[model samples]
Target: MAAEALKSDFGGKAHIALNDPKLRANFRRAMDGLMTKRAAQFADADEWNALRARGAAVRARALAQLPELLERLEARCQANGIQVHWAETTAEANAIVLGILQAAGAKRVIKGKSMVTEEMHLNAHLEAHGIAAVESDLGEYIIQLAGEAPSHIVMPCIHKNKVEIAELFADKIEGQAYTENVDELTAAARKALRGRFADADAGISGVNFAVAETGTLVLIENEGNGRLSTTLPPLHIAVTGIEKVLEKLEDVPPLLSLLPRSATGQPITTYVNMITSPRKAGEKDGPKAVHLVLLDNGRSRVYGDSELSDTLRCIRCAACMNHCPVYTRVGGHTYTFTYPGPIGKILTPQLEGLDCAGDQPHASTLCRACADVCPVQIPIPDLLVRLRTEAVHPSATAGVKGGGSAQSLSESLGWRGYTAMYGSPLIYRVVTRLMGLFGNWVPASAPMLKQWTSVRTKPKFAAKSLHQLAREKGFSHD
Candidate 1:
């Protein structure tokens, strides 16, 4: 899909979502449940901080030596008889996977819950090429039927209510009555998907982590659909970003511990599938042919920048989105990208390029709540500020001049003046008196002054600055 089309669709859907009380309520309930469960899970684990630290360290180490690690991973996978392909961009990645399917003469593909697939819009690509790609994950299948994008990272259809899902199923399934009951919906989805699973020529999935030492592709999921997707078909392909690689096998345990708690608050997912290679002769069930596609897209560029390199450490737990006030109010579509929320604010600009997505960096309130809650302690707020700095730099600003031109210049000057005033008490007093004079010009009830008055009414202009007040009150200047 074109970026403009995706952006327009996202904006329209977001407007509808904003007015949807049912969706809003559902999101609130789901977010609250997940957060409460996560907090409780972490409360008992005294080593949570240490685990987060280790997780961050592991990711950092992997990024520092990503090329070496990827080479090692490819070698190990090749030794185990798994085919690996390297794609420098999205088009190349899609072509590599499509070529594998065509080479196998596969007409049908069953896909698990893979955000990378969503990022690549793989289903649409397959359909455009006359291949049928069935989404096996319950939520993903529902979205595919509805022709909509996933709203949440882990829970793709979090925006849908049970009633909406029931209606969708009833419309899609022959001779089925609409019902909101959970069991009925689940049974309907299962019946619809069983045939696809049995007949699919290939299974495609996303890797949560790729271990260099063992060449293992790790998938963590609650639904077990991922396991089926990787094992049921004769051919299996795992697509993942280059950043998903880890340095050592030992790094997996700490990351595994952090993921479930941070994602859905489960101590462990119902299933964790580790696939090192294709099925061996003794194996009764597993794909006979296995392939791994390491996708770069825009990650390699991010790795070169010091400020953005840390973003490669994200485990995709999406804790930041759950805790983000802006994300909650605006929903995921406002982000206009694959990822959303505070991390998106930083990552999207870097991945998409600041020239195309510079506005994203300024979307945050810089509240730091996301930073506080992040499992890996990524300095998300700090990154956002840096991105904004880059966006408004002289050259960048000159390229995008418009209505905010005067305001931006004024704001820049205001910051410069404030910095100068902070160097001396006398200068600070002069600045405050000037501010007090300006404050007096506006009516107290004016919208511009409302923010200041809401918390405390603007103080009457002082004859002198705080330094004079301190001196008059007999307080030492020191």
Candidate 2:
């Protein structure tokens, strides 16, 4: 499925979860634990701010010379015996991956956690072609068996509780012991996946960063499945967005420094595998063939637009989502896309267009917390405002313009009136006094006032307006 299609389909179901206690508990426990760990990790790193700055600079430099870097990367990879393919769209990317699998005559495929593949819906597409795509990552494996899209970026099954997982394993795994203990369930999954990994004709994974200097692909994961996926199979395929590129090899350390700290609160992930090319002569168990598929899929459009270009700096550490109060309450499913949280809100609109992702920009609280916590310092709140403006005001060339209704006209007029009034204190005092007269009419329990009341009590209106009070106090105002 296309990214927008999947988002639309899943977003509808996320509403049903608002009343689900079990799911809410699952979300709260996992998210809270992860967030606490992340806070501790950041606290330990005294140079966290410095690391973020360096990471941002590296990504900015890479994006500035993306065309040149991609060319250099392609040449280096080819020289190292790794074939490279460019895909301009999701369908083309999926087709390229499937064609490669077909050429290898592969029947079964083992996959590590790769959100790019999820964005392209590569598994479903491959299944339609008679290939069994097995998810090797434990969380991904759980979600795949549940026939659901991932709820979180790094942790796919974050919404599933242990009992639910035990039930899933009981039904799926033949003769497996049914246990809710986390370790037992993980062991069961590992036992099941080990067979698939050994017998699979190919392995598929995602690239965290592709270094142009050495033509190296990096994968960061807590589980060793990423290592297994990249090494064990005879054929290895990596699918990633074009934004994953890094200009020079030295630029990697700062990004690596920031990612794990921001992501899961670890100083570094358990495994950070760097693959330069396919296994050479006398290699001890590595893929014989290696292919890297670089996906554009609307990223180029974002790069061209100055207002939204900062979104391309995302390393997908998912820190914005972790720190977002809105995401913590509503969860990733509410965004209903491959990528979720604050980053997802800005990114989905740019990738899928304003019309397709209408709910995303409005999803934020505009608290600016996400922007403050972002590792790469993408002005997420500012971008969201830009997207909301575009959503509310479609282009005149689109035929159906925005300002057609009486309500919209009134809103525009009200904004203009407020702007003019606020420019002069005399007019502002007049409006303020006028509003004070009607303040008593506003009900304490008004639904429109709930959000304000939730945070603070409504201020008692003064018996006299500021103008009257000033006059009573004998304060002369020209």
Per model, state how many residue pairs clash.
Answer: 0, 0
Clashes of 2: 0
Clashing pairs in 2: none
Candidate 2 residue spans exceeding 4 A from truth:
2-16, 393-477
What is the Cα-based TM-score of model 2? 0.86
* Candidate 2 lDDT trough over 10 residues, lowest sum: 398-407
lDDT of 1 at 269: 94
Give per-residue CA lDDT, model 2, range 286-371, as digits (tens): 99999999999888877876657889999998888877877776677777677888898888877776656656777777999888
Cα-based lDDT for every prediction = 0.82, 0.84
Q: Tens digit of lDDT per residue, candidate 1, span 1-478?
A: 5642443233345568778788778788778887888888788555888888888888889988999999999999999999999998777888999999999999999999888887787887888888999998898999889988887788878878898898999999887789999998898888888889999999999999999999999999988889999999999999999999998889999999999899888999999899998999998989999999999877887777766688889999988888887677667766777788788877777766666566666667899989977888899999887777666662332222121222466567867877899988788777787766675676777764565686587666655667667878999966
